[model samples]
Target: MDLTGPQLCYNYTSNVIGPGELKTFKCPASIEGRFVRITKHTVASTALRLCEVIVEVNADTCTILDLALNKSATQSTTYDDGKDHAGDAWRSVDGNLDPNMPVGQSCSHTDQVGHQWWQVDLVRYYHITQVSIQNRDVVPHRLGNVSVEVSETNNFDIHSEFYDAKLCHYYEASDVPASTLLILPCSDNIVGRYIRISKFVPILYDVLSFCEVIVEGGDPSCIQGTTGITATTTVTENTTDEQTDTTDSPEITSTTISLPSTCPCSCRGSIEKYYNRSIESLLDELREELMVSKKETASYTRTLVSVDDGRTSSRNIGYVGIVLLVAVGLSIVVPDVVSLAMYMKGK
Candidate 1:
């Protein structure tokens, strides 16, 4: 171990400890060396106080998990202009490895041309060891000439590939089989907060589409000295035009995602901003609450039917309740459905 070298096992930046107060720092990864040295720099020479130091291996280092499942994802564009949101980018990390589209509705698609890309934010830096991707069952050749990259920053351009990133793997023409899951192992140094798959060279009907993406790794650490919370989140953006009829529209909650954890300091406000600004988030809340209300209403109706004395009255009440529920559901649902359409168009 180079004590005076630029590399470090860990950096401590917390406040000084008082008497009888113990401070612990955990290294992100295992650091194997012969000596464990502690150094403190001060402007002037001073007496040093000593306390017992303890070193233990982090159990999390041995536990490898999918770091990209249900995390925030974005792509160059939604396929077919978000007609039914069947080609949204969040589908790749939804833990569904189905390679079929429309039938399975499990894939992230982008517009034409090989200049498109899709990415997932891990919310923190991790030593990414492997990336598993599933190709679409139909026209699997469209997913050619792609590169899997990792970066610590989100400074990406839709039309450009200029960024501080490392190339982990590149798949040239027919590298991955059709309707198959391919797992590519990355280098040990392939550690970053963002894992992006980009295609630069154009081919026949070149488009970026994936059914699922799984990032496996462990030994995570905060990025940029900021402590961030990690959680399962999915953000959907509908670009469909507004329409008056809501009966034939697709369900907005088909791709379900839960709310994230409390405010994470290391998120850099991007995740929080997305949830607050996205109309889909509000629609999700409204739809979930509506479902809960519908269930409760049905339960109440069941209870009333069970306690009724007359069969005729019970049948009449049940029929009336069903009609009323449908009416009320339409009355509230139609307006929001229209609003969602308009919101998507506006965005």
Candidate 2:
């Protein structure tokens, strides 16, 4: 319930999010918590609104995997028709199944120019067993006649464009419906780093769109089976002392559970370090400017004090000049006869 204390497992500081933009943050390790809390730290006049927040946990088993989750994905061409929304390729493997393409902002779309395809790079070889796809709910027919192909190398050529990779499953026009989850299993021993859903045959005004794509499989080189540990619980009863006036006896219980060191990862894009660097640089610049301003202010103060001292010296000299002038005028008006006569006799 509290932001700090034992309940708090991790803290995340976010950067600016643009309008209609989705930002993702990935934790380095899986954190187990009862609730996920979000709080704003900036002082801005705008309101804080969250479109969605998704938390993904590890799959049940250690053998199977979601290999394509948040992996590198690309499309042939993004759908662009003077619209503010996007049909980016990364949306397919973003682990979001919201099929409403228009407002959901979770589906991937391609232009209706020619042959369209969306591909994900697994980064490593995996013996892919099955691929799950969710079609766009708005226009379900756009995902028909798609071929799920796998290849170790993604290099395409004139002859055998998919680099002669094996086809996992091909879906005809009537195979899948709108907003439906289709599970297509590949042939045995289909090992590759790239999985592509493509429509190769040229058709006029044909576009490709899908909500989500999940690639599940095991490591090609290593396949180690994992098991989970069961939790154990112990209960103890405390007896109340006769002298103490407590009526009920309290029960104390403790449980021991072992968590997996590593969990199935759906990696997300992180800007944590980027924000950290920006903030540090900003503080350093502010400190340097503050020091410069302090020096300039001190120098200006010294200059003002020096000017005042010069004015005071000039005023004192003026007073001495006025006194001499008054003495000479008085001697002219009424002469000092005794002192003058003495001075003349001495001369």
Candidate 3:
């Protein structure tokens, strides 16, 4: 296999994995590979086991759509001719479900050793639904306890690696043979471009093999659905003021009128102009009334002063007439009294 390719898509070193349990992994972009390998890295005596591997090609829903069909396949070690050969990896994804194929005709086989793996590349990113693997018709007992991983990169080195990938699914073997296809569906929307199937247990024969690996899902670009729409709105309002004159009670002057749209500011300008004209008219009327009131007050004050002066002059003329009458009476009475006294003394 291409050992110098990108980093691995998934890796597991835990020894607590039990039989019949499921595990999963995912990536963010596309991965390119042809083999998925497994290796025994833990201290447990359990053997590294794998029956099949699959890659999703559509959304997060498992269906008959296998995106890994006709894709390339590679392995860590291949068996010789007449034995389980390496080229059998492609036949699993070839969509031929003929379980009755002759030995080594429908499945790929690897040497019995540690750190063996198989990988496949899907070319581009896909919204993976689930991966399904079919166990070999012969010796299904060896296909137990395997680690499955998916990633956007091809770095197979599980140790000291950095990439965007995740374990979307995993499975622990049971005593019963995995004779039928084991379907490992992705839980969340796990997207990836590549898939890896590996074994990391130290069993008696640490050989990694599988009959078929089927990836079911679709391309990320062809997604179709509805989305939300956002919008914004603004509103403007105009107001009017009215003034009334109760003196003559003319038709109530109303400033409310239709605004003309000659420019953006024309409407507002017209309203302001009407208000200014009305205020100016009101001010002019008030000034005229104040002038008239001032004139009337001045005329009334002048008439009052003239009448008071005439009364004072008439009183002064009557006092002078009374004083002249009293002086005339006193002078005549004294002269008559003096003539009578002189006549009586002579007699």
Candidate 4:
């Protein structure tokens, strides 16, 4: 009997996953070896589910139809006719219909339709690092059973992986993963082109369904939009004085000089030249000292004469001393001569 082939399946599974809705669907055992492609996808932005279907075929087994749970991306399908879906990337839902269905997971949803489980792999296109899912949106939605798969090639399961539609452009990662967060090794520095996020439970309206996705490593600016600093100082005042060598403030080193007790007139002249003054002042000071020391001799005569530059003029001490010495010489000689003449006349 011509039982089952590809593309031919039961009624296309439909779901109303909102605030309070949940359901599960499955194909009969007779539909093995067949493929099921997504024809329609609709769900609110606040419901938590992994409700998506796909006839999964992997390894050495026949195709098995399954559902999904808590996934990364949300509703609003984009027809591959080169045009993306015209609706919002996420939707809103109210789960008033059902409340017992479980939630879906991102980059990690495994939908079990009966005796089999289906897993989505993101190795082919995405080098995923962290998988974050949360429901913080003001408009809560539901996540139906969604399926995901990965592979290196385009189609045809390549060893433990399923293939997804190829996309171009880097998807931004989340900061606060407003819903649920999954830390993944493949997420940090992931590099892929496609990530299909579908529903998990056909019927569990876990209200406030959300998923936050993040990549691992690369340009932090490109991922998180951040940029990283230095510091500096102004010129300081030098402690060493700048005027030390300036001509304005001459530096005088200590020095000492010794002179003999007495010298010829030449020495006096030299002393006067050293002081850059006339010798009259020096001689006046000496005369004053001599008059004070010993009352001037009887032969000493007061003489008034302008010396050179100023009032101290010349009271020549040397001249005074010479005059006294001559007077003493004459006095001694006269006494001796008078005695000798008396002796001669008496003889």
lDDT of 3 by residue, 93-143 (tens): 666543433633666667756766677788886767678777766566555
Question: Which ten contiguous residues of candidate 3 have the minimum total lDDT?
Answer: 226-235
Per-residue lDDT over 7-123 for candidate 4, one digit per residue giving the tens place of the 0 to 100 score: 344564545535433334455545555335544444645544453222333411111111112322333222122233122222222211221223321111222222112223333
The lowest-lDDT stretch of 10 consecutive residues in candidate 2 is: 263-272
TM-score list, all predictions: 0.45, 0.46, 0.43, 0.20
Q: Could you tell me which 10 consecutive residues in candidate 4 have the lowest summed lDDT?
A: 59-68
Worst 10 residues of 1 by lDDT: 222-231
**Distance (Å) between predicted and true CA of 74, model 3?**
1.5
Q: Best-fitting candidate, measured by lDDT?
A: 2
Please provide the root mean square deviation of candidate 4 (C-alpha atoms, Å). Answer: 38.2
Residue 54 deviation, candidate 1, in Å?
Answer: 37
* Model 3 root mean square deviation, Cα atoms: 32.5
Error of 4 at 106 (Å): 18
Q: Over 4 Å off in model 3, which ranges?
A: 1-64, 81-87, 100-104, 158-162, 175-178, 221-347
lDDT of each structure? 0.70, 0.70, 0.61, 0.34
All candidates: CA RMSD (Å): 29.8, 25.8, 32.5, 38.2
Off by over 4 Å in 4: 1-87, 90-126, 137-161, 164-182, 187-191, 204-208, 217-347
Model 1 error, position 289 (Å): 65
| lDDT of model 2 at position 207 | 81
Q: Which of the predicted structures, 1 or 3, would earn the higher TM-score when compared with the native?
A: 1
**Candidate 2 vs 4: which has more lDDT:** 2
